[model samples]
Target: MAENGALLRVENLVKSFDGLRAVNNCTLEVRKGCLTGLIGPNGAGKTTLFNLITGFLKPTSGRIHFNGERIDGLPPHLTFRKGIVRTFQVPRELKSMTVLENLMLVPSDQAGERIWNPWLFGFRVSRQERQIYDKALQILEFVDLQHLRDEYASSLSSGQKKLLELARTLMCDPQLILLDEPGAGVNPALMKRLVERLELLCHELGITFFVIEHDMDLITRLCNPVIVMSNGEVIAEGSPEEIKGDERVLEAYLGGQYLAGT
Candidate 1:
């Protein structure tokens, strides 16, 4: 809905911590339905930028627009309601809850959540809860977590937890998902499944993804028109092959080894 066909856009955005500028006059866009990659070295402000976009951190200046509406400085819950959702690098699962329960908790304002409604409108509340439960089961099946629906989140492996995180986001029916270091701590076998699921979500389900990852191989395989950030600024935007051959990108992050492989 944004002008120029960008689903989300940041203009001259800045975030400062004391005297340090973590994100300095940065700007970018995530086109609708694209699997966009954001790659940068440590201290390059990639996470800081995500924090700003998701309303976890307030920007000091500039503007953020989602679907053609200004959303800078909105609270995290407000952003979530606007169909922008984000996942942490380390999955934030409720360890004591069952996988199904974890997914069920994501949708806001269920009729059964109100005490009076549950007591006065018992039939309505029961029906609403059944609907939510059915949707949670379908999402678990999509992410291959249906088999663990009754298992406590604490019992799952690191990779499964990551999958659980993705399943939880689906409950919100988000328009765009910001994934931070999704490949981190995931084994190669699990990583392949994750990639396939992400692809299906983007292509088949019309969900857009903006991902930050350190794994070049994963970025190369999954993303198009990759965005490179260095010192809190985007220096290049290109295809996987173009990014690999870029001299500035090589010097700033990718380096000679990446070029050699290319």
Candidate 2:
């Protein structure tokens, strides 16, 4: 945990489908302004847990608190408005839109979105649109995508798309961002850049991150208080060094035979 207080807490989180539990009584907490890692082998219910926290899926039983307020049953949009945002393993971009347009669309509260705004006050709507455009460009610059701001999202490479997705997440000014496999399909060079940007965002922008990543090296370098899960339950929680040397973690990552030899 960081010196700051707990920003989010999960208590006895449980989720099941067809009588088979995908997430089993998992409990964890994310410290404010800290980077946390969530790791597990295949079928460990990592994504399911994310879905539950982000309100994409409802839990069978559990509680989630953000800034001391209960948020378990809130819808995704409400959770987002409350300063929790999540990115997918695959970048979800509007292929037909420009990168800048994509960023502009991320802000949840749009004044012009109402049907009456244009008809009642066209001038005000235009001014607000310009402001949104300028903000979008600034965010693109922050993500180092300013040069491609006008290009269609479909034209971007996978790494660029991932960066765009991260940029879009920032438009909301999120307090806690949940990244699901940010490096899954990204190239090594761009992956390194992504890690650096994430570090800067936490250190400079004061944003908290709860990352779900399989890349142990990336997790070790970027996150503290790593959480390890196996068979839908948290098996260990500690610093990178402790997790690396843990017997249960090794068993979860490598199988019992390898752990026995170790």
Candidate 3:
């Protein structure tokens, strides 16, 4: 049920490793300013699709577009620069760095990265660093992690690490974000926090999210026009209620997965 005017588009996309097709003829749309959810059974090509969209893997065939520009075959860093970024299921924060430091590191074109820039434009670099730190503090506060800004990422719980990862992603100021199983190990309370933060970001910041989530309740509560996949292809797309009731989905997944959480 993909509609027109999508901010992200996947058209006849395919990926293969050796002789096996991991993603086959996948086509979908992610509209701007929506919190889209992608749900599928294991080996449904969810992560493979994410990798292709994020440019971590070159597609075996087909095309991808973001913000009206072709993005397929671009490198991951180039894709990120085009305002599409992704977060992993396991939070990838730097263990030794403070939460605020982690966020500061995500922004690109930093003045401190080059060797000569430090001496030639040290004052400008310091000013830029200060600005980034201030913004990082604001983002940490927005995600309700300001108090933990100075804490090492390693010391945080599984849930807090996820929160930190989300906050860091914000530093990049992406227009579209692809998230892989954000609630995998989070507790209920922190999961609620993550959802609330995501809602606020979506509405207020106008950030678009395409997430892979296994928690039925979470997806049903947060997403609309939910998309379901099976055998590396999209099999169903509709409201959460409609998807949960789809006969095709039931036959392929929901019938057995209904009792299991993901």
Top candidate on TM-score is 1
Better of 1 and 2 by lDDT: 1
- Pairs clashing in candidate 1? none
Runs off by more than 4 Å, candidate 1: 258-262
- Looking at candidate 3, the ten consecutive residues that score lowest on lDDT are 253-262
Candidate 3 at 46: error in angstroms?
0.5
Deviation (Å) of 33 in candidate 3 = 0.6
The number of residue pairs in model 1 that clash at the backbone is 0
Q: How close is candidate 2 to the true structure, as a TM-score?
A: 0.93
For each candidate, give its TM-score against the true structure.
0.96, 0.93, 0.94
List per-prediction Cα lDDT, in the order shown: 0.90, 0.88, 0.87
Q: List the residue pairs that clash in candidate 3.
A: none
Q: Cα lDDT for residue 202, model 2?
A: 98
The Cα error of candidate 2 at residue 59, in Å, is 0.5
Ranking by TM-score: 1, 3, 2
Off by over 4 Å in 3: 1-3, 257-262
Residue-level lDDT of model 2, residues 1-262, one tens digit each, is: 3224889998899999998889999989999889999988888999998899889999999999889888997889889999999998888899999998898887577778898989998999899889888888888888789999889999999889989989999988899999988878788888888999999999998999999988787888899989998999999999988887888998888764333332
lDDT of candidate 3 at residue 14, scale 0 to 100: 95
